[model samples]
Structure formats: C-alpha cells, structure tokens
Target: MRRAAKADDNQPVIVKSFRQLGWTVAHTHMIGRGFPDTVVSKQLPSGLKFTAVIEIKDGAKPKSSQALTPDEVVWREAWQGEYKIINSIEAVLEYHDWVMKKF
Candidate 1:
C-alpha cells in the first residue's frame, strides 16, 4: 500500500513532541484560512511567558509553497515579528529553547 504525502503531514507529529516539552499548544484550525498552524506558550519559573506562532511544512523538495501567506505575514508584522517557518520537530524545540533564554 502507498500513502499520500501533503505539505502539512508532519504537523501532528511535531505538535505531539511540543506538548511533551511543557508547552501549551494550540492548533489554529483556521476555517477562514489566514493564520499559522500552531500557537504555543510556556511560562518560566520567573513568571515570564513566551508565546510563538509557528507555520509548519513538510520536509520535502521544492520548499517554495511552504512560505507564509500574505495574511499570515500581516499577523506577524502586527506582532513582535517572531514568526517561525518550521519543517522539523527539532526546529520547533529549538525555537522554544531560544525563547527560554530571553526570559
């Protein structure tokens, strides 16, 4: 048997790993279709909360279509401009680690 692979097949796998690391993860499930796939936040012991928006893509060839859409761009610009385009689980964890040091 064969399986079909699309651009966002890894989102659930990455979300599961993110949850294991103590982040409160949420799927945008954007019915209107103008946002990132996931949003997550974690709190430090020092009472600092770090939140991030992540857009996920499959680690496949021709990475062009995975780029952020125009509306997603608007959302990032309105925020702290800390948006991430992720294709791997490690990148997601690394992003959290990078945010951890800031708090």
Candidate 2:
C-alpha cells in the first residue's frame, strides 16, 4: 500500500515566505505519485504571470535523506516545465530575487 505524503519540516515556513513575496501557492503534496509539493505563481513587472513546480526538502536533514525517490525521478524526467527542489528559507529568498531580476 502507498503511504500518505508528509510535508517536510520547513514546508510551512517556505510556503509562507512565498506568499509574503506575493506568489500564489498551491499545496500539492497530497497528490502523491511523485508530483511536486507546491505550485507557485507570480505576476511579473511585465504583467505576465508564470508558475513553477517546487519540491521542498528540509536543509537540516542529511543529504541522503533529501534525495528524491524513484518515483520523483521518473516524474521529473517526464516533466517539461519549470521545476526545482528547494531547501531552506535562504534558497527560497534567493530564488525569488532571481525571478524578480529576470522578469
């Protein structure tokens, strides 16, 4: 039997951070089947909005613990869109800044 999905320890904080930055976040962890944890979208200065799929992993965890599962690998390989595995608030902030600059 498949196990229930659990959010990483830092997931709530990360989702809050994204919201604070004006991004709309949709939690998708319960969707399972290797789907990413969240989908976040923001409107750029150019009036265009873009969305990205994010998989959250706690940075405090060991590297081995943070490794993606086999199902995740398969899903990622088949996905053809903006996707990232993010760990920590700093990384989230940095990514937001990068998006601000790029758009």
Candidate 3:
C-alpha cells in the first residue's frame, strides 16, 4: 500500500513566502504518487499570468532526506511542463525573478 504524503519541513514557509509575494499557492501534497507539492500562479507586470509546479525539500536536511522518491523521478521524467524543485527561500526568489523576466 502507498504511504501518506509528507510535506517537507520548509514547505509552509515557502508557501507563505510565495503568498506574501502576491502569488497564489495551492498545496498539492495530498495528491501523492510523485505529484509536485505545490502549484503557484502570479500575474506579471505585462499582465500575463503564469503557473508553475514545485517540489519542495528542506535545505537543512541531509541530501539523502531531500532526495526524490522513485515515483517522483518517474513523474518528473514523464511530465513535460514547467516544474521546479526548490529547497530554500533564495531559490524561490530566483524562480520568481526568472518567471518575471520571461514576460
């Protein structure tokens, strides 16, 4: 049987940070089966809204603890879309900056 989904220790902080930055965040951890943990959307200055999926890991944890599960690897490989793995608030800001530049 499949196990319950667990959010990384930093997930709440990341989600809150994203929301504070004016992005809409949806928690997707309950979806399980290697699906990303969150989906975030924001409207850029150019008035184009974009959505992206993210897998969150706690940067403070050991590398082994942060490693993706086999199902996650499979999901990532099979999915063809804008997906990112973020482990720190800095990475979140970087992603925001990158997305802002695309418009």
TM-score of each: 0.76, 0.96, 0.94
Q: What does candidate 3's lDDT look like per residue over 24-54, in tens digits? A: 9999998999999999999888888899899
- How much is the lDDT of residue 63 in candidate 1? 71
- Of the two candidates 1 and 2, the one with more favorable TM-score, higher being better, is 2
**With candidate 1 superimposed using the best TM-score fit, by how many Å does residue 51's alpha carbon deviate from the native?**
1.5
lDDT of 1 by residue, 1-103 (tens): 4333233778887888788888898887353245677887888778987787777877653677667668667766777745777788788778768777767
Quick one: best lDDT, which candidate? 2
Sort all candidates by lDDT, best to worst: 2, 3, 1
Worst 10 residues of 2 by lDDT: 94-103
Candidates' C-alpha lDDT:
0.73, 0.94, 0.92
Best-matching candidate per TM-score: 2
In candidate 1, residue 34 scores what lDDT? 53
Pairs that collide, model 1: none
Q: Candidate 2 lDDT, tens digit per residue, 16-97?
A: 9999999999999999999999999999988989899999999999999999989899999999998989998998999999
Inter-residue clash pairs, candidate 2 = none
User: With candidate 1 superimposed using the best TM-score fit, by how many Å does residue 21's alpha carbon deviate from the native?
Assistant: 0.8
